[model samples]
Target chain A: MEFSSKLLEKAVNEMAQLPGIGKRTALRLVLHLLKQPSEQTHYLSQALTTMRDDVKFCKNCHNISDVEVCEICSNTSRNHKIICVVEDIRDVMAIENTNQFKGIYHVLGGKISPIDGVGPSQLNISTLVSKVKMGVIDEIIFALSSTMEGDTTNFYVYKQLKEFNVKTSTIARGIAVGDELEYADEVTLGRSIVQRVPFEISLKNN
Target chain B: MEFSSKLLEKAVNEMAQLPGIGKRTALRLVLHLLKQPSEQTHYLSQALTTMRDDVKFCKNCHNISDVEVCEICSNTSRNHKIICVVEDIRDVMAIENTNQFKGIYHVLGGKISPIDGVGPSQLNISTLVSKVKMGVIDEIIFALSSTMEGDTTNFYVYKQLKEFNVKTSTIARGIAVGDELEYADEVTLGRSIVQRVPFEISLKNN
Candidate 1:
């Protein structure tokens, strides 16, 4: 779209660089910012700049944090020996909300997707391997999604820690609690049947 | 959703304040920005801040511009005797894209929407009236949308310029090109029939 001012065009172009935003959406967003008070724009810009310049990651888990070490990693009450490996910080939040896992997390930052030019080396895999080599961890749980990339990353990390004496397990795959068995996909249904637990064991969790 | 880092939360909150963006989308965008090079965030923040602080509006037509007077108002080739009133700069760009209107534009910034707390005094209507009082403009065209607010704004301006010698007209309302008559809205179809022009007049534009 044609913009009368070069400054407006520049701002819209920069906004459009985002993943899902297009030029038209960028223009609309920029125009909305223009219509709002100057302080709104100032705060937005300041927040983004400050975050980019000063945001830190948990040195141990690779999750985003304001401090060098995140709260979960430093919490003595949690079982740090049982590290749950996941894709990113969002996964950490999701698992934390469930309140079922008492174990700490190892954020991989992202999955290994070769098609997207993201390899194992590009992720936070090395640090995790080093953590595993320290031999302080008792069990490692793979909590990544069921996508191919998630499985590949899990397998790659498992291979890296194969020589080390560590027990590794993946999160269970089954139909959602409210879902009907008839509607479940074949792969998930088959896996759920094969991995069926003792009736008493399932009842104990409930 | 919970954010591990306060800086990330602040950025996401600011991003979500924009129209149509929610907390989830904001988090996704902020995370995407974090994954990119730091320079990307720097450029986006810099552009928005610069645009918000330094952007200027044309003194004459109130259209967004880099200079005191916009290009259209400063141009000697465009007709100075004709003025087309529009709601905002987007309308100016839309009309310009058509390449049909040779007259200059007078952007009102917004229409008179009482529900939104927008009044004529808040708009650029006064400057337009003063320009009309100068007796330089020979014709004034209302190109605002056919919405209630647009119609109210047009009528308000038309009343203000009633005593002036200049001719006043509105952009025609009719069935859009390539629209089937049977499927057209009743009001639009009725208006199209009542305002029908000579058969040759329709062919002239084509």
Candidate 2:
């Protein structure tokens, strides 16, 4: 779209560079910023720039943090020996929300997607290998999504750690707790059946 | 959602303040920015802040501009005596794209909407009236949308300019170009029939 002012056009173009935002949406957002008080735009710009300049990652988990190490990684009560491998910081937040896992996380930053030109070397895999090689970890859990990229990353990391004396396991795949079994996909249903646990074991967990 | 980093949370919150963007979408956008190079974030922030701090509005028409007077308002070829009143710069851009109207525009900035707490005084209505009172303007066309607020704004402006000698009219309300008659709304179809133009007049325009 043609803009009357170069400044407006530049702002909209920059906003459109973001994923999922188009030129029209960028224009709308820029116009919204224009309509509001100048302080609103200042705050947004300041926050974004500050975050980009100062944001840090946990040295141990590779998750986003403001300090040298994240709270979960530094917490003495949690079991740091059991590392939960995941895609990004979002996954760490999701797992933390469940309050089920007491283990620390190892953020891979992203999955290994060759189609997108992202290889194993691009991710935070080397540090994780070194952590495992230190022989302080007891168990490693693969907590990535169920996509093909997730499986590929899991297998690649598992192969890298095979020579080392580390036990690796994947998160269980099953129908959602509130979902009907009839609606479950065939592959997931079949896997759930094959991986069924003992009746008493399930009772003991409850 | 819980964020490990305060800076990340602040950025996400600021991004979410934009219209139509929720917390989840904001988080996704902020994280995407983090994944990209620092220059991308710098450019985006700089553009938005510079636009907000330096952008100007045309003194005559109140359209967004970088100069004291907008290009359209300063153009000698366009008819200055005839003014088309619109809600915002987007409408100005839309009309300009059509290449039909040779008259200048007066952007109202917004329509009178009680629900949104927008009144005529808040918009650029006074300047338009003063321009009309100068006796240089021959005609004033109401080109706001056909919504209730648009109609209210049109009537309000019409009343304000009643004492002046300038002729007032509204943009025609009818079925859109290439729209099926069967699918047309009842009010618009009825208005189209009632305000039907002469057959020769339509032929001459084509």
User: Highest TM-score: which candidate?
Assistant: 2
Ten-residue segment with the worst summed lDDT in candidate 1 chain B?
B161-170
lDDT of 1 by residue, B1-206 (tens): 77789999999999999999999899999999999999999999999999999999999999999889888999999998899999998899899999899999999999999999999999999899999999999999999999999999999999999988679999999999998889999999999999999999999887
Per-residue lDDT of model 2, residues A103-122, tens digit only:
89999999999999999999
Instruction: Give model 2 RMSD, 1 decimal.
Output: 2.0
DockQ, per model, reads 0.81, 0.87
DockQ of model 1, rounded to 2 decimals: 0.81
Tens-place lDDT per residue, model 1, A109-205, is: 9999989999998899999889989999899999999999999999999999989979999999997888999899999999999999999999987
Every candidate's CA RMSD: 2.2, 2.0
Best by lDDT: 2
Please report the TM-score between candidate 2 and the true structure. 0.94
- Location of the lowest summed lDDT over 10 successive residues in candidate 2 chain A: A197-206
